[model samples]
Target: MTAADLALLDEEVTHCRACPRLVEWRERVAREKRAAFRDQTYWGRPVPGFGPADARILILGLAPAAHGANRTGRMFTGDRSGEVLYAALYRAGLATRPVSVSADDDLRLIGTRITAPVKCAPPANKPEPAERDNCAHWLRRELRDLAELKVVVTLGAFAWAAWWMALEPVYGVRPPTPRPRFGHGVVHQMPGLPAVLGSYHVSQQNTFTGRLTPAMLDDVFRQARSLAGEESRG
Candidate 1:
């Protein structure tokens, strides 16, 4: 990502007040845990895109974690979910590092970027339909800005639905009779973007219980890499 792109994203995230409920919840978390993340400014407002702006693969996640991205300002940082996702990305040769703790940490995405459907940490981590719709414009703009984007990796069913809805119009495809169901490692191709891969979200439940193993996640990335015409080191 260019410096300009990063700056713009930062500015938007800092000033984002799209959902008043989210703002209130994040502020409460920030105030309650002030001592925990004193040095790291709580970006409790809204999270933004992270990793390379020129990324060819966009990783779509559901939302920021209350104690994770909400506390650390960077998406997927300071969270178990991010740890699992980053490890898989590193193994697949998509990431320069294995962990994402903070924005200042040295990490890079060669052919990938990670974003969320709802940028803010919602109450109970659930964003209502109106909130998701409100944030769709930003996601659309991000996709539009990535000139080299060829693939999108959606983490969960919600993310998959949002992405599919957002891109269907751009691709001019007739909506599916019964919308495709989400499954781990399922791949779908659209007219505009050749590949859209779906995977179970790397939440604590999946990772801790071995539902989504590292090797399994790596295999998904390997497929994504192949579809994107990128070499997979894993």
Candidate 2:
């Protein structure tokens, strides 16, 4: 039943046109192909969460990259940000491969699933609050479907806030009054809900600038595995 529910929810995510601005941005990016990928076809729709249905760790990010996920139809694929993330996941023994060039690649997340607060690629990589709110139901549904979800490692503050919002509406988990702010390596444990961890995003700004090192990223996943009670194979 849970598998069927998650499959259907993922299917529903691709057809969502709830936000006009997001729709325009994602579609336009798809239509206007980048020179490097001009020979390739773009996915240009709401990206869906993907991984083992019973995954215990959820890696939540802000949104899809305009050329990355918007082009590959898979979360965190075909981009540098994804390169950093997938490599780290592989080193952590959570992913089958260390690279994700396209959705059809031989990449697999072992016990972790990846998602975003906003499904669509927004203009300038920023989704308006209304667009985020409009897209919240997809997350709400995904969270409800991840029956074994135990820990969430949020890539940035947006994902951090989104998970907090999902707690009450999706899981009936009311976070303590005055919600906690996001900070890398910080873990938030609350009653009757999965633990949440914050991490700096794996964008070039963080990676190339040395703000988030490979060791730092590995530590975050190590912490996530520890929190989820999973044995480390990395």
Candidate 3:
């Protein structure tokens, strides 16, 4: 990412108050848990996309976690959800490190990038449709900036739907027949710039209960890497 792009992202994230409900909830979380994260300033602001701007594979997560990305200002950082995600990314050979504690940490992605449909941590982790719509601009801008994007891996049903809807315009065509469904290892080749892949979100419930195991999630990334012209070790 260039300095200009980073600066623009920083400006957008810092001043993002598009959704009042998310703003209030994020502020409350920061206030309530001040001591535990006193040294870490909450990026309770909108979370920005992380990793290479020219990434060929973009992973779309549902939203930021209350104490995860919201607290750390980075996508998929500082929480149980990220723990599951980073582990799978590492196993898939897309990530150098298997941990994402904070944005300042030295973690890196090779051909993949991570982002969310809703940038801010929503109340109860559920965002209203209007709030999601408000945040779509950021998603659109991010996708536009990814000039070499060839694949997108949506981490849940909601994220899958959001990306599918957004890409229709970009591709200038109707979605493919039997639209992609959400599963552990579902893949969709759309008539677009990038093929869309689906995977169950690596949330706490899915990870802890074995609904979405690390190996299963890693398989999705393996598919993504393959589509992006990278070899998959799995």
Model 2 lDDT tens row, 56-140: 9999998999999999999999999999999999999899999999898878898899999999999888999999999998999
Tens digits of per-residue lDDT for model 1, 9-127: 65676687888888899888877765666666676768888867677788999999988998888889888999999989998888889999987888888788899988889888799
Per-candidate Cα lDDT values, in order, are 0.82, 0.92, 0.82
The list of candidate 1 runs beyond 4 A from truth reads 1-10, 34-40, 169-174, 232-234
Q: What's each prediction's TM-score?
A: 0.91, 0.97, 0.91
Greater-TM-score candidate between 2 and 3: 2
Number of the top-ranking candidate, with TM-score as the measure? 2
Pick the lDDT winner.
2
**Better lDDT candidate (2, 3):** 2
TM-score of 1: 0.91
Instruction: Judging by lDDT, tell me the better candidate of 1 and 2.
Output: 2
